[model samples]
Target: MSARHFLSLMDCTFQELQSLIRRGIELKDLRNRGVVFEPLKNRVLGMLFEKASTRTRLSFEAGMIQLGGQAIFLSPRDTQLGRGEPIGDAAIVMSRMLDGMMIRTFAHSTLTTFAAHSRVPVINGLSDDLHPCQLLADMQTFVEQRGSIAGKTVAWIGDGNNVCNSYIEAAVQFDFQLRVACPEGFEPNPVFVERAAGRLSIVRDPREAVAGAHLVSTDVWTSMGQEQEADQRLALFHPYQVTRALLDQAAPEVLFMHCLPAHRGEEISLDLLDDPRAVAWDQAENRLHVQKALLEFLIDPAYQHA
Candidate 1:
């Protein structure tokens, strides 16, 4: 209870993080059984998006409504954040009006700046550097399909973007192992890598990284703003594609995963993504359940029946 902000996976402790996941599972099961609950009554979540998204927008709004709370969408064009106003000032103001703030923006520092000034909880819907909410769904999916995350190995192949960053952070907390395969110049942040020195292992070969891993994860070769460099990236990242041959190096129970809106033949092959062991769809659906649990936790700290 009383979580002031959710800027990154590292923002939460290991136990708190697991609590949210377990609570998410319970909420999901309840919803499937036709149970309804108003856990966040009279709460309003302000969702600010400087970047475009389909899943982020829909999951958060729907999650809020499902919990008996309301969500207000704020696009870049609709807010003064676009015109020139500082996020600090906006954060101070919005914190007074809304119960929580969910921001999907460019820089991680922007959300940090907002959290610094805001009194209410701020969730990192997404950022150029980390996507904690997405990983919440990911962790839930891991637990649901694999039963537990501790001691499991996860392999990441492709551009080391926000999702990969959060995955590393999740591994740091959950006692899991992670191996990443990215092009020479496209490696993850050096600071993050250093922070994970003892906990994580890095590799250059996609196949080598995926070897014996329980879950294989990947994202697009080119992220949203990197469209201009898509051609070059594709050429350079071809070796990192999650193909059937690559998946063969993983454990027999290895589950394939990718954040939605995949490029089919680019970062991952269609056959691999559609494989029976692929848990991409379950990962996407978990987004809603995790957010619902998060909302309930943030709104009522005293309500601890998880």
Candidate 2:
């Protein structure tokens, strides 16, 4: 059988994605109950990062170790691929040695090229076009805190960046309505919007989108490699910030989320993280459990169906 690659949420069937989330919750519960499950014992995962990370690095590395597997972290400065080695050649070499590979890079095409040549499962840690792994954790978080997200409404109140793009895909896989409030020029990729058809609505007013939403999510106005555009983004995105008032506009039980390393006063209010409605920390921690589940599914043959 050909190896599976999780470069986007679209890579997996809805049923498969739901199965993964269920398994992730089980894993989290197991860990909480002091159950020792290490299906990935003796396996190795290689992580290649072209961009710097905190949660992505810590979660994947620690998750592997917790699963009784080892993870090798490779940065551009440490690998030949950083020094002009072709992605295909590097993927071929790395896949021969590792059980699987996860890459956090800038371009989506970089991930596609590497996965094309890889012999083992390839995971997309993050890319300019999508951050599927983060969505896994986010979905898991919502499931844990709010039960099934199906038939619910989710609000996206910031840039139409990678995280927003992934949320668009998540709306389809998880069966939810997505209301996106972004600046005119900052709308999510047109193709993704079209793909989501009846499931998504793009609006200019954050309050309109958040009203009655079950969940509210936003990301930094300026993502990596876009430092030069920070000033411009802030001006355009100021009205879209997920402040306390905005959270109140959502459902009474609405939960707030932000993929972290948050700028305190930018996309979110400085005090929002401390608000009872914001589940950012829980969402952040779920990255470990959900990713552990992902690794088990990809590397442990016996655990693939579990």
Candidate 3:
């Protein structure tokens, strides 16, 4: 199987994701011991970011460097893509010049178009609709901490945004129990939820959804363009915040997680984020390892290992 583009969790099979996670775990261990591999020696990754980022840009670039590959960053202002060039044309041209492409943008359709048109594999760095790479890191972290994630419950207690969408996909892939707690009208995208139905539980009450869960995850109450609704969302999501009191509602060993750039006292409490049970930093670090595995799987000429 080719690992060219990582579009969405739904695009991968359970076995494919297992291979990715396993490779990521091994790469992480090797990197920690100062071991180095040149699987993508001389390969170049073209990075296109129409949207702004912190983790996605740094992690992918860092991962490429660690794997003996190079990356070129092209922001919206730096490319023809800014001047009415079709996404398909841009992707086609980039593919011919680079070994792979990592795009962080708005629409999922744009990346889909890029993948459909490009000769090289296209990785979805992030899109408004999904964040599969983040989920890869998250899945690996879960396994690293708990041995195995199957059947364990993970509670999502915030906006039904991209992060929540990715978590739902991960739950289905691993056969784990996923419970999402959002305000009445703030539930996850119905299409994704329906696609993973039977394997997911949607709840209106944060406490009820979190009860008995092994992991508690949350994201910002107001995401990037949603800052206009900050005051309103703050009021709506107040009860959904992962506080010390709410943490008590989950299984005793429950751990807290967040895709960082955290809002100290909003979606999660400072205490819970700093708690010994929080593996947030590990999750951050895994982003680099999993990204390296993904690049190797996509660009390495010899299919020896990812």
Candidate 4:
């Protein structure tokens, strides 16, 4: 059988995703209780990064260690893939040594090409087209704070970039309603829009999108490799920032989330995270938990829930 890959949120069944969210919480509890559980003992995960990351890098590396496994970090300069080696060729060789791999790259096609030939599972850490891993953490955080996200209204306020695209997928997979507030020129991919099947609505006004929403989220106005477009994006995205006043337009019980490494005054207000409603820190910490469950599911046959 071919290996399963997580290039996007749609890659997994709804039930599996739900299981992961629950299992992640369980893992977090296990860690908190000082219980040592290492189902993936002696296993190894290869992390290939073409982009720099703080949370993604630390979470995956530390999670593997905590799970009684090991993770090897490979920078673009440290790998043959960055030296013009074909992704398929690199993946074929790497998968022989590693139990699974995660790639954080600029192009989504890079993952597709690598996973096509990889014998081990390939996960998307982040791609220019989608960031499924972050969504897993976000969903897990929401479930921990509020119950099931199904049937809830989610407001996405900011650039309609990769994270927004993942939110669109999450809306369909988790059965939530999503309203995206972004500029006209920065809309998410049309293919994702088509896949949403009406789970999403696009609007230009941030307040309009957050109206009565249960969860409000945003990301940086500019992502890695987009520094050239910073000023222009700042000008276009200024109106979409998630402030206390803007979130007030949502339901009184609404929660806020950001993927982390967020710009203070760009995608959100400077003190937005200080509010009890902002769950950004929890979202960041949950990345480790959710990914630990994912690694167990993909690699350890002993994980009964997988």
Cα lDDT, all candidates: 0.87, 0.93, 0.87, 0.92
TM-score for each candidate, following the candidate numbering? 0.96, 0.98, 0.96, 0.98
What is the per-residue lDDT of model 4 for residues 170-287, given as tens digits with 9 covering 90 to 100?
Answer: 9999999999999998999998989998899999999999999999999999899999999999999898888999888999999999998988988889999999999999999999
Q: Which sections of candidate 1 miss by over 4 Å?
A: 1-3
- Residue 74 of model 3, lDDT score: 91
Better of 1 and 2 by lDDT: 2
Candidate 1 residue 148 Cα shift, in angstroms, is 1.4
Q: Give candidate 4's error at residue 74 in angstroms.
A: 0.5
Model 3's alpha-carbon lDDT is 0.87
Model 2 regions lying over 4 Å from their true place: none
User: RMSD of each candidate?
Assistant: 1.5, 0.9, 1.5, 0.9
Candidate 3, superposed: residue stretches over 4 Å from native: 1-3, 304-306
Using lDDT, rank the candidates from best to worst.
2, 4, 1, 3
**Candidate 4 structure lDDT:** 0.92
Flag the better candidate by lDDT, 1 or 3.
1
Residue-level lDDT tens digits of model 3 in 36-63: 8877878999999988888888988988
1 versus 4: better TM-score goes to: 4
